[model samples]
Target: MIRRPVLLRAARPVALTLLVLFGTGTGTIDLWAQPVQKPLTKQAQTELDTIGAELRANARKREQKHQSARQIAEEMERLRTQMIDIARTQGASEKRAAIYRSRLETLTLLEADMTRRLGTLRNKQSRLLSALQIYSRNPPPTIFVSTRKANDAVIAAIILKEITPELKKRAAVLSEQNRDLIRVRREAALQNEALFISESDVSEQQKQLETLMADRAALEDQLLREADAIEARNLELEARQRTLLGLPSPLRAPQGRALDLQLPVVGEKAGSYGESIDGQTNRGLRLKTAPGAQVRSPGNGRVEYAGPLEGYGQVVILDVGGDYRIVMTGLGRVYVDPNRTVAKGEPLGRTPNLTDKPTIFYMELRKGENPVNPASGFDLTKL
Candidate 1:
């Protein structure tokens, strides 16, 4: 009797049933005719499940490493900016510049190191891929076959031989499938190796970037520390110059020689000197006007500064004659250029949304370089 190829397909699962059938002959064959489901063993299923989980984890790790590399590149950019700033700011001082140079050198070395490590990993990855390709395409060794005579027993043997060829074909398919699996495993290994090397290099880059950042921070701190003392010294020098010029220590209200300082626009004069507005002393009267009010020159002067000055955004400093300088801050845009002369009451700029109510320009007076409150020179009582 001819046995179906399906019988061989179920060989492993039907091992126990086949053995009992072979022992009882005809009676057991009838029992074996009924279909019975048999699942893979727990250990075999667990092994397959583990491979899938491993593949998923490897993919996840690969993604994480790529993200880490991106982060490292960003941090490297930040460090490069800091390096540029340091080179520009501290390059004059040999000691400070040397510090910056050292940091730059360190970062450069780190970059080169990372490049070398990445190259090595890439080569390793390529080799692994090549090995995997060869393993996949090259087939496994085939099983040997035996050729003999045919008779009553030979009929049974021939039937077995015919089915055996089908078994060999099935096994070949399985062998190819296993080879494909091995290729996948090798590829995953290569990915893992690359990720490991890349991550290590990225880690080193992060450290170097952090170090450069700290150096930049130290340089900034040094600059800030010297800035206050320099500013104080400048103020002292201005004060001494004022004393030498025979100007009063503090110009008293309505005491200075009168100069025709033109008004910007007719707005309600609100406050005076030593008075408080917005929790700060009102150095000049707050003129309450509509939002985006035009401000004009107090007197003809040459524009000295026409940009942001500390605590005053978009300011203009004009050198009015007789050592007088008028500073108008909180401007939206400047209408005049530096060194450009203007007549009395010429438009300087406009103030927009200065305070909760309508905007007012923050005006101050500086004689030469000494900032004298505008109230000291103007007659505020008249307003």
Candidate 2:
């Protein structure tokens, strides 16, 4: 006997509850939704579509005939490869993470709001249902068709005309919310499974990735000394020039020229390069980042500068090869010290965990002595 998936097992009760809530199963219309913060690039969107398609394809596989042990092993290898590809590609991976984060955030806000609204709706529904049950004791009156007299028909028509539109609108909103909740819950379940995989019975592929992450996070004593020396030298050079523009490009250039980069952090675009603010022109893109969000290196690079400034919070600069440098600011903490070789997508630090408002993160990509439009510096993909 085949055991149905947990989702399948609980579907009926979920459906029934939703039906009772709205008097019809529902929620797809964004009745009271706020605008979502969209930061994905074209490539990132494409990558997401690909991932979703693949996940769906994988789901379809279960409906087919069961496989042998050999076939299962082969499938596992294929899945491992797929996971690695998704994880390493910062654009798709980070975008997905951002989507998940934002979605959960939005869902939280909506759920809170909906909890109150749903309670009211449920109360209204209860009254309506009670009246419905009482009326069911007799033949329930339809607008005009079921009325016994002309005056009764006119009264019923008048009442329905006043109530029908508002009731229908509320019903539609409830239906859409129900659907959205179901979808969100399903995704949350998948994340729980992802979390479980990390905790126990870890896969070899995941272990290898974890090892790399741990290694990147750990800095040796020697690396720390080198980073400090480099940071000091860069500061001295900047002082001599009396300028902070493109400070990392001239010194300690990386060997290989990276052809691409992911955004250093996920955020809503708060400011952009060349935009004038309070009479001063902005030199880099600024983002309103998620609270306590992990900042990642945009590309494979050496940490040229990672410390704090007077007004700005913690900062990190990366020499991302071929004299191309990335300067990031507004981190709450710097994870990588100076002079350490950091891989693309490696965790650099985190934004301040302030909840009142989002912390602003600033990033600039420069070559030689000038800041270039971030898009011109390299392929800037979504993170």
Worst lDDT run of 10 residues, candidate 2, spans: 1-10
Off by over 4 Å in 1: 1-257, 278-280, 353-357, 373-382
lDDT of each: 0.53, 0.58
RMSD of each: 43.7, 33.5
Question: Candidate 1 overall Cα lDDT vs. reference?
Answer: 0.53
Report the number of the highest-lDDT candidate: 2
Instruction: Give lDDT tens digits, candidate 1, residues 1-383.
Output: 11112222223332534432343343323323433244335654354344334434444453343344334434545687766664454434444445545555554565556556545655665565566467447534334323432243356446656756765665565556555545545554554555455445444655676787666444433432243233334345435423332334543336564455755644556555558878987665556554334567888778988876777778888888888887777675566788889888787765542222455556677787766666544545434
Flag regions of model 2 displaced more than 4 Å.
1-258, 378-383
Residues 141-185, candidate 2: write the lDDT tens digits. Answer: 555444356566567558757876887788888788777767766
Residue 185 of model 1, lDDT score:
51
Task: Provide TM-scores for the models.
Answer: 0.32, 0.35
